[model samples]
Target: MTTRDALKIWIVEALSALGPSTVPRIAQHIWENHEAELRQSGDLFYTWQYAMRWAGQILQNEGKLSKAGPGRTWMLI
Candidate 1:
């Protein structure tokens, strides 16, 4: 899958696993959980900022997620 696609998939999995969480928190969890995968893939792994913006855009576009109180935490609805 493409980098953005991989990010989206990861976000979905993380949201399901952690429920609502801030982007940084999610990124930390994913980084720790998938360090092996990241090492094999190199820099396309995406940082916390990209994950946050990309996921919010993708999920908002798809209507699977929503902003809650205009903060970092995203709500899956």
Candidate 2:
């Protein structure tokens, strides 16, 4: 899968595991759990953070995640 696709899954996994969490915290979980995979993901190691945000938005649009308010954590729908 592409980096953004991978991030879509990871974001879901992060929220499933952590229950609503801030973007940084979700990123930390992905980094902690999938560092090896991410490092081998071509340019993703550098762009995953930005891609993660995009993935989260996509997820929200897909109804897999809730809309995030200002300074709010991401939640599953």
Candidate 3:
């Protein structure tokens, strides 16, 4: 798979592995463990955020996840 696809897989697996997390925590884990795959971000996340919002929206829409807080914490539904 390409890097973006790998990132989606990594994020899903990480969410499954850790349960739930603040976006920064998830991003930190990705940066720490998957550096090889992560080296290509080129600062896009800091500027635009990554796909976290998009994923949460899709999951929430699908009823697979829900907002856990008024802000960024999300949980499986």
lDDT tens string, model 2, 13-70? 9999999899999999999999988988887778999989999999998989985755
Error of 2 at 30 (Å): 0.3
TM-score for each of the candidates = 0.74, 0.90, 0.59
- For model 2, what is the error of residue 75's alpha carbon versus the real structure, in angstroms, after optimal superposition? 0.3
In the range 1-77, model 3's lDDT, one tens digit per residue, is 12354555556666777777777766776677677645556554443235656655666777777667556665655
lDDT of each: 0.70, 0.88, 0.61
Can you write out model 1's per-residue Cα lDDT over 1-77, one digit (the tens) per residue?
A: 23556666777777788888887777776777766766566566555447557767888799987667357587678
lDDT of 2 at 44: 74
Model 2 has an lDDT value of 0.88
Model number with the top TM-score:
2
